[model samples]
Target: MTTTSPQIVASADGTPIAYESMGDGPPVILIGGAFNDRTTVAALAATLAPHVTAVVYDRRGRGDSGDNADTFAVEREIEDLAALIAAAGGRASLFGHSSGGILALEATAQGLPVERLAVYETPFVVDGLRPLPAEGTAEQIRAFVAKERRDEAVRLFLTEQVAVPAGMVDGMQASPAWPFLVGLAHTLPYDVAVCGADLALPADRLAKIGVPTLTMAGGASPAWFPAAAQAVAGAIPGASYLTVAGQDHGVLHNPDALREPLLTFLR
Candidate 1:
C-alpha cells in the first residue's frame, strides 16, 4: 500500500493536476473538501490504500495543480476529474469530503465514468437548525483572497459559512493545519461555488446519479450533518447511508473509523 512520489496529469484545458496513487486495485480518487489540499486527505487515502487504489489529488488553484481558467466553474473541476478518470483507464470510483463531496456528485450526475461514489459529511444545509451563509459571503471571501488576505478569508469561511464556532476556528488558526488552510484560501471561492450560496441541495442533479452511492456522516457532528447526509442518500435512488459513531467533520485527520465502511463499499 505504499506510493511513489506525486505525478502530474494535464486536465482538460491543460491544467496540470497533481496526484498520488497508492496500492493496486480499483482506482478511487479522493477529493478533499474546502481549505484542504491532497495532504489533508492523506490519512484517509492511506487507510484505504490496501483495499483500493486510493488517488489523492490537489484540486485546481491548490497545491501543485495549475489554474488555467480566469473564472472558476464546477464544470472545469469536473473536466479535471474527467482527465484523471481517463488516466485511470476511463473509469474509477470516487470519494469526496464536504464541498468536495458535492463536486463528486455533480461529476457523477453529469455522466462521468464513475464506477462508485462515496461521500462523507457533504454539509448541505438541509435542516433549519443553522442559518445559511449570508448573501455575498462568497464574494466577500473572493475579495479577501484577491486582496491577499488569506488568513481573513479562511476565518470568514470557517466561522460564517462552515458553521465552525469562532473559538474553534481560533484554535484551528493556532494549529499546524492553519498554514495549509491559509495557503489554499485562494481556492475558497471554488468551494463556495460548488456549495451554492444558500447551501441548498441540488435535487435534480442527485436524481440523475444512477451509480451506486454511499453517503455518510459522523454521529458526533452537529445534528444537521446526518440530516444532510440522509437527504443526499435519499435523493439518489438506492444509495446507501451510514452514520459513523463518535466521528465528526474533522474525521479526515483521524480516518481509521472510515476504513471498514469504505472498504466494504468500494472494494
Candidate 2:
C-alpha cells in the first residue's frame, strides 16, 4: 500500500487544516460529506493517486483539523478550501460529496480559483422530493451539541435533515460507526449551514460557476439524487452529468465505481 505523511495548512482564520497528499499529477482535493473526516475519503484519494495528486483533508471541527470557533459559517469553510487550494500549488480541481458538494459550489461562487469541479449526489431538493429542514434547525442542532447530547444530535440530523428512515437510523446506531458519528455530531451544523435551510437548488448561484464541472449520481440511489444531480448539472453552463452504475449515495465506499468517471472527467 502507498503511504504518505499528513500535513497541516493554516486557513485564513489561522485554523490548522490536516491533510494528506499522494501521487504526482494535477492536484485534486476530495471533500467528504456529513459524518465524514479525511479518513473516510482516503480510499478514493488512493484510487486517484496514480493519475492525480489527490489531497484529502478533514473539514473543520472533524478529525485532526482545528476547531477555532463554536459558530459555523459556510464562508469559513470556503476559506479552508481556499487555503487547501493554495497549498495545492495555487489552483486545483475539487470533488465534493453530499453537503461537501454544496460547499464546493459555494466556493466557486465565492470566486475560489477552482480549475475543475466534480460532485457526487449533493442533496439539493429541487422537486421537493425530500423534506426541507424546519426553520431554526441549525440552532436546534447547536443546542443539542452544546449540551453534549451527541446521540440525539446525530439522530436528529439523520432522521430530520437527511431524511433517513427511523428504522435505518436505528440500525446504523447499532453499528460500530455509530460512536464515530457521535464524535463528529457537533459538525452537523456546519453541514447544515453549507446546505442552507431551504435546501432548494440555487440555480442562479450555480450558473456563475464558470469552470469545467461534472455532476454525478448513482443509478441505485434514492429518487431525489439523480434529480438533484441533473438539476445542478443543468444549472451550471456546460457541466456534464453522469450516473454511476449500480451505486448509491454511499458510492465513496465503493471507490472503484467512482474512479473511472472521475478520471475521465478530471483528465
Candidate 3:
C-alpha cells in the first residue's frame, strides 16, 4: 500500500533531526553518507517502500536537520540515529552507504537494537588501498567553507578524498548547482574520522556482533570500496556479502539497480 511521507522532528543533542517515513512494515532506517541529506536517498526509499518501511533522515548539519557549533563526531551521529530509531518505535533494520555504513557498524557494535544491517562500501582503508589526503587538505577545506567557497571545497574532496575522475570533477564544477554541492564540504572530516586509523579493528571485537548482517559492494564500484566491504563481511560471523550490478557509491542515484538485491538480502 502506498503511504505519504511525513517529516518527524526528532531531537538529538538539542538539534532538530528531520526525518521522513513511508510504507508500513518492519521498519528499515536509511542513513546517508557525508554531505547527503534525507531526500538525497529518496529513490532508494521509494524502491524499498513496497516490501519494508523505509525511514530516511538528514543527519545534523545537512538537509532539514539542525546544525551544532560543537565539533562533529561519530558518537553524535550515533545519537541522531538512535533518536530516529526511537521515533520509529525502537527496533529497525539499517541500511548505510559509505560513511553511513560505518555509522551502522558502530551502532551495531554498541547494541542499538537493530535487527539486521546492510552496509555498503564503507571505504575503511584498512589495507593501504586508498591513501588519505595530505595534512593540509582538511585545513584547506575548512578555510574554503569559512570563506563561503563551498564549490571549491567540494571539488577538492571529490578529486582528493573520493578520487572521482578528474574529468567528472571538471564537469561538475560547471554545473549550476555546484555551490550547493559544496555547501556541506565542512562535514568531510566526519567521514574521514569514521574511517580513521585505517579501520584496523581486531576480529574479536566484530565476533561479538550477534545480528544477521549483509555487507554490500557495487559491482562496477572502485576496487578500494569492494575491498572494504569484503573486509567487513569477512570479519563478522555469519555475515553475507554481495555486489549490486551497475551500482556504485552513488547507489541512491541508481536505486532500481540495487533494490532487488537489497530486498532479497534484507528480507
Candidate 4:
C-alpha cells in the first residue's frame, strides 16, 4: 500500500508546513511532541481517523516540512499550526501531546480559531514541575545524536526527562525503533522551546482564552507532568481536567486507553 504525501501550506512567516489527512467527521488535527513526525503518530491517527477527520503534520524542520537553519522560535511553530488549521477548512479541533500541547495552548492564547483543544502532559514548569536535567541536558542530547547513539538519546529522553518507568525504558531500548527515536533526539530542545516560558502567562492573559479545553494527564505519569497539566488547566477558563488511568506520555501510541477520552472531548 502507498501512503499519500502530506500537503504543504505556507505559514504566516512563509515557511512551509506539511500535513496529511484521513477519515471523515469534524476535522481534528493531531500535533505531536518535539521530534515526532506524522509517521510516529500513525497508530493514534489510525484510531482517530476512523472516527473524526484526522490531520497529522510535521512541525517545521522534520519530516517533509521546511527547516530554518537558525532554529525557529516557539511563536513561529504556533503560526505553523495556524496555517495547518486554516488549510483544514479554517477551523479544527486540536489534539496535542507533550510539546505539541504547549503549541496548542499558545495557539489558543493567541486567539486562533481552534474549536476545541485536548492536550496531554504539556510539561509546563509550574507547581514544582521538575526542571530539565541540569544545564547540559540539551548538550548531552546533542552529543548522543552526534555519535549516532540515536537510540541511546531516545532512551535517555524517555527515561530521564519523560520520567518513563525504568522497566519500560529497558524494554523499549531493545526495540528496533529506539535507534530512529534517538536520531531524532536532537530536537529535544525544540520541544522545550515550544513550551516557551512554561505557563509564563499572567492571570488576565490566560483568562482571555475562551476555547473549550480539555487537559489530560496520565495517572501513572510522573507527578511533575500531572502538576504541569493542572497548571495548564487552572490557567484556562472552563477547561476540564481529567486523568487517564494507566496512561502515560506515550498514550498517543497506546490508543486503546486514550481514544475514548480523546474522542469524547474532541468530538
Report the error of model 4 at residue 12, Å: 2.9
Candidate maximizing TM-score: 2
Best by lDDT: 2
Which ranges of candidate 3 are over 4 A from the true structure?
A: 1-6, 197-205
Candidate 1's displacement at residue 199, Å, is 0.4
Q: On a 0 to 100 scale, what is the lDDT of residue 216 in model 2?
A: 94
- When 2 and 4 are scored with TM-score, the better candidate is 2
- Per-model CA lDDT versus the true structure: 0.90, 0.91, 0.78, 0.77
What's the lDDT for candidate 2?
0.91
Please report how far candidate 3 places residue 260 from its true position, in Å.
Answer: 2.0
- Candidate 2 positional error at 114, Å: 0.7
Which residue runs does candidate 1 get wrong by more than 4 Å? 1-4
Instruction: Write one digit per residue (lDDT tens) for candidate 1, span 127-214.
Output: 6968888778989999999999999999999987898889999999999979878888999999988988889989878999999999
Q: What are the runs in model 2 whose C-alpha is more than 4 Å off?
A: 1-5
* Displacement of the residue 33 alpha carbon in candidate 2, Å: 0.5
Order candidates by lDDT, high to low: 2, 1, 3, 4
TM-score to native of every candidate shown: 0.96, 0.97, 0.89, 0.83
Decoy 2 TM-score against native: 0.97
Query: In terms of TM-score, which candidate is stronger, 1 or 4?
Result: 1
Sort the candidates on TM-score, descending order.
Answer: 2, 1, 3, 4
